[model samples]
Target: MGEYKPPFTITNKILSYISSISEKIGRITAISNLETKPHLRRNNRIKSIHSSLKIEANSLTLGQVRDVINGKSVLGEQKEIQEVKNAYIAYEHLEEIDPYNIQHLKQFHGIMTRYLVEESGEFRSGEEGVFNGSQCIFMAPPARFVPQLMDELFSWMKESKDDVHPLILSSVFHYEFVFIHPFSDGNGRMARLWHTAILSKWKPIFEYIPIESQIEKFQDEYYRSISECHIAGESTIFIEFMLSQIDKILDDISVQINEKNEYLPEAVQKLLEVMEYDIPYTSNELMERLGLKAKEGFRRNYLHPAMEMKLIQMTIPDKPNSRNQRYLRC
Candidate 1:
């Protein structure tokens, strides 16, 4: 095989983000005791699949994604619904995946793109380009080079596992995988799922972090980072961005855990767990975090009750959904 040294210059900023992410990962590992509860684990896996597919423009809402995963019928385009199903199937087999195995990578792509693409598990025979509407943002290397390039990349990853930090390695792999654009379809989803696979191998807590949920929240930035990395011919920016997302997700989980431990009334406790005491969060963010699907029901039961209980306060007292609407704990 060729000598595979991925292109990326590590800087202090990258180091700083990696250090912060590592600390957060350590904290999460300690808090989780390396054991994620079954219900929470399932919820996170659903969120990961939903958010990743949503980033790819799947029309299914998180609620509908949950329904589909639960074996309930969801009203959406058949392809989108199938995307959710395929993602769940791939994630269910995460335990059996060898993250550094190239064959496993193709297997995952097959599972993730089953019935959704003509060339499901196979790398593209034709060339590929990433398009944003009429604009072509990225073009992959020639089709003939894919197998060799992917093999070299995986070989580099396997060799670098001990020398490089998992956070940096996973982020680098994610950026490079997208840059390669090996598959005819499902490359974006594969990049995401594979990065999570890499991280879960390093720390089991990552299997439950739902970093894809955070990525969906920052979708524009996510693409921008990739575009910038492609232009720069290095993965540094993308690595930093992914590590930041991971750190934020870890912070949110930590906040969720600590807030749940607080002594509060049953009605407002869930609200408090979702809210930040200092930083304001949008109602949608809070509701999504709490898994509340109905805005009216959420307001009447959770939001209004929390407000009435003097436990949470609105950023704009007069305007609920305008003029910078957000909520924070009292």
Candidate 2:
């Protein structure tokens, strides 16, 4: 109400999570230029967009979102598809955002909600509610209060940049932003995007981290954390909850990196170095991407070994020579 300072305590659980996440960050850093790995970076960004939209009840699969972003025709409702396209653009332009700038948050929200909401970048002039089907769970603060509320939140964030760990600060901002319900729609998406944006500013590697995917994986728990904190009058639960999610996501990333490093065939690893994964590639397409014209030598050294190692598999495994066949990383 007055000048808002988020109330929260860093308990032992939060400290442990911070410690674990830091160690995992060191491990994840070992993959030289992992933040620059095009495939990983693109895939993570797509995953973030897809999952954040999914949490908002957008009925599009991850592949469908990826396809939409790739400029392909996706058969879905016009509004849902537009949301995906908008989110993709918003994330791709994240470099233009400033984490502690109130205007930047409004600008990003405009990008996020574009055609999906009439209010877009503007704070709602009417009351809004968080709902479960027909039932409302929480009514937002009065619309008149939004601008000043947002100003204080951003001012606190800027002033606390040195005093707060980005992890803790971002999570606190995330919870508070959701509580403020600053926009007419897309608050959840903005919260998630800004959380990653805040962390990415802290360490560029976070640009490639799919923390939203983890939130989508455990969505019920995510809502529960917010609701509990709302009742408890502090964001400590949400802070610990977020730190726990980061710990889990970083752990998963470390495992994936080590698995590929230890087991993938050298040729297949090289192939992936050039390939954008989760989509299929035909033999000719694969060869062309690698700039190899001789089919047999290319197959023996790269394709066959990759298949033998199961790093990649044929799309039509039953008929390996199917004319319509393609290959995808496993």
Candidate 3:
């Protein structure tokens, strides 16, 4: 296969982003216990799915996305809910798919667009464009050229995997995927999901970093970056924007982990385990169960942190010092 080279120049801004992201990645991976924290991983996955879908105007709220992920039934538009299910299934198999394989890309698009599109796994057979309220913002390539274009892109990626940093490669792939608008539907979702797959292949920690959440927070800038790159005939701006988002996501996760660990220390976790979800218990009982003689120490370390995190709630908030005051796991 011939090499595929898209028009893009790497600038100082791009290099700076790549360097910052690398440092953040190193810092996050230095946390010895992070990978073992399944709760945090699951939370990040849910956020990733929800924010990516939200960018596409999927109406499911983040809470609703969590419920769906936990297998709890949620009431919503059938199609929107199905989109969530399909996207979840695709993400769940991130390790199984090769990011540089065209077939795997199509398979993921199939999984992501199942039941939502008539041609789930196939490239578009007709015209496609990025549209906004009756205006065509970007027109994709002709449909007939898609198969060749995709093959060349994947071939280039496979060949360049070692030479290119994944931060740049994934971001470039994302822009090119959107630029191609390959599928009849679900192009945006595919772009986001596939980029995550690319990054996860580079470093497994990325599977847990929900960069899409950061993208959703700056949706307008995201679109503008893409459009600017489209007009400029290069993906430099998009790559810069994506790497910035990735860096911000890492910062957010660091803050979240620090806050979570601070609020839920080992002592607080032990206290939580002893308390019932609904049953209220007095401070004396809680302290006694922990074999603690010092009331002030118990409150300072275990009780206060848990309460501040809202994992437990005071039964008598209005009378904190009352003799009858009690607390229950919130």
Candidate 4:
């Protein structure tokens, strides 16, 4: 086996960036401990953003990523878009059941590429190219490397004793795994998913960080950083780039948390918590649960306020007379 050595100059810069971001992430972690519905909403919003970004990055067309971020559905591409959404939903649930195992990886990849690509859940069995500019630069290791590399990665995850921060470890693992490019087609998506799994193991809050969105925001820079570090034989620059994105995303969520704390009504907030586990409620169902005498009273006093605050949304906005008209916690 070749001994791994990182580029010193880029490593130094990355370590510096990690140090700065760690302090900011610490603050976000602290605030997340407050047990409030608005805080929970903020957390869910972050998770939604993260899931959306992961789906967009993996399955959607380049233009689709922009459309999804802009709060628009890909109109003619519903099937493809739904596949991405399903992938995110799968990750959200499956990670909790088994985060690091290969089973989860296969499931994520399957959902990510269901109708979009033929090699959805399988690893690449032949040679693959890594491009730089117009040139094919690095050739991924042969098919034999896939199992060995994956085993080494999981073993390293299990046996590593150094108290290296989870964020740093996750970022490094991401870069290295993608560099290895174990899969034929979905290597990038797998790297991002595994990174989330690694971080979520450390702190559940990280599962909601939307690091991918930040990556998509600086996609060009992200690619450049990875390529530069790869060519220079250092993973540190990639680590630094990831850490900075994590910090920025955490800060963004923190602001939303604080805003929700200040403005949300207490009763409506309580309603939100109750519905977190079970959403999409009808007016009668909500009134019954809230113990209000009149359904109209509940709508005027509770639901409308929540809707106006953008905390809840009507699932059937056009069907006023429909008994099935429901409200969902957004």
**TM-score versus the correct structure, for each prediction:** 0.79, 0.94, 0.84, 0.66
Q: Each candidate's lDDT (Cα)?
A: 0.82, 0.86, 0.84, 0.64
What would the per-residue lDDT of candidate 3 be over residues 248-280, giving only the tens digit for each residue?
888887765554455457987678656643457
The local distance difference test score of model 3 is: 0.84
Candidate 4, 1-330: lDDT as tens digits: 223332323366566666766666676666655344443543453344344444334355544543453357676456556555555555556346344476667677777667666767777778786654355546777887887777666556555525556777777778877777777766676677678778777766666566666777777677788787778787777887887787777667676455355466777766665564224678777777677778667877788888888778888778766877888877
- After superposing candidate 2 on the true structure, give the runs of residues whose Cα lies further than 4 Å from its correct spot: 1-3, 132-135
After aligning candidate 2 to the native by TM-score, how far in Å is the CA of 123 from where it should be? 1.0
CA shift of 197, model 4, Å: 1.2
- Model 1's lDDT to the true fold? 0.82
lDDT of 2: 0.86
TM-score of 2: 0.94
Error of 2 at 42 (Å): 0.9
Query: Which ranges of candidate 3 are over 4 A from the true structure?
Result: 132-135, 259-265, 269-301, 308-330
Best by lDDT: 2
Better of 2 and 4 by TM-score: 2
The TM-score-based order of candidates, best leading, equals: 2, 3, 1, 4
Show model 4 residue runs off by greater than 4 Å: 1-22, 33-74, 97-100, 115-117, 130-139, 259-330
Query: Taking the tens digit of each residue's C-alpha lDDT, what string does model 2 give over 12-55?
Result: 99888888888778777865567446777888889999999998
Question: What TM-score should be assigned to candidate 1?
Answer: 0.79
